[model samples]
Target: MALSTNCWKYLVLTFNALFAMSAVVMFGVSGFLLYRLFVYRHFIGVNVEYPAILLLMMAIITCSVAWIGWRTAKSMHHFHIVLTGVLIFLVVAVQFSCFVWAMVVWDSVDIDIKNSMTSFFDVANEVNNPNSPESIRWDRLHVQKGSVPFSCCGQGPLDAKFKPYTADCSTLYQRGCAKPLHQYTRQQLLMVAMAALISSVLQK
Candidate 1:
């Protein structure tokens, strides 16, 4: 038992620096994304901003709690040791909550995207006056990524394109963007959430 405790002590000491470094990087990146999302919110939708905010919060809390844990671990006081354990428990709770939140977000992403696209087109299509600012912006958006225009016909695989059969629906990725994209996105994020949950549990 003594040997195991000593091993953990040294490991924490070794990793505390790395933890601090990683926290700083996460904080910076998430903060930047949260800030920039405002400008591009209209283009991609506001779905991204919320996650960035969540990420920033997690980074700050994790880093702060980790430092307290490290400090309390090094202390000889019984109270400090108890505080350390409590802090670790709090981290585990937060991680679990984050995992749950991520899954919920995963389920809603497709619906959110569909609504955003629908709302955008309703206002963007200045078909009667192609020279209008909205029409110009809509055309510019389409040209930005030819693959995006060609990939999905409408919101989902079952959905038909708003217009008649075109090269976009006939030739390129024969499906709606929503289902496949949602599957891909959820798969990626699930892995991340699982990793984070496992890491936090292990840390505890």
Candidate 2:
């Protein structure tokens, strides 16, 4: 049986509200990711921020469209509803592009991350001379970040011993930073998929 127009409108409104909440979450997470990237660019690699910026842009757009969807749901104006649909279509396209880009990045992120870590590892290994650049940077990171070395990432992994002229996997974290990065990206993709699925369901 066909749902009454009012019922359909209410249902769409609910979906829009949920999607707006998702946008809020995405905005907050993306903003935090951007800050982390800025602070740890040396170790994380500067290029990683490109996708984050795009995600932020998409979050902003989604917020605006969700607001429009809310208004359309209430007014149920034919033209406005059509406009909202178009907006959703655009968002879906953007989400697809993001998902694809994320997948591509995911494929090679480990290699890229390991390459970036190599330099930092060298610095950690050479952290004996107080005046040396590597020592200074290494000390600054440990003192400033206060994260578990080899066990933590973001800004760079800290070695457990922190002894000068020494490096070993025994003290370094076994799990690579790529795992968390991949997890976060996968979450973002899942959110996009959920939004698209919700929109499709609402249309029916």
Cα lDDT, model 1, residue 80: 73
Candidate 2 clash figure, as a count:
2
lDDT of 1: 0.59
Q: Judge candidate 2 against the unseen true structure and give its global Cα lDDT, from 0 to 1.
A: 0.64
Instruction: Report the lDDT tens digits of candidate 2 across residue range 14-39.
Output: 98988788778777876776675656
Worst 10-residue stretch by lDDT in candidate 1? 144-153
- Which 10 consecutive residues of model 2 have the lowest summed lDDT? 147-156
Q: TM-scores, in order shown? A: 0.58, 0.56
**TM-score of model 2 relative to the true fold?**
0.56
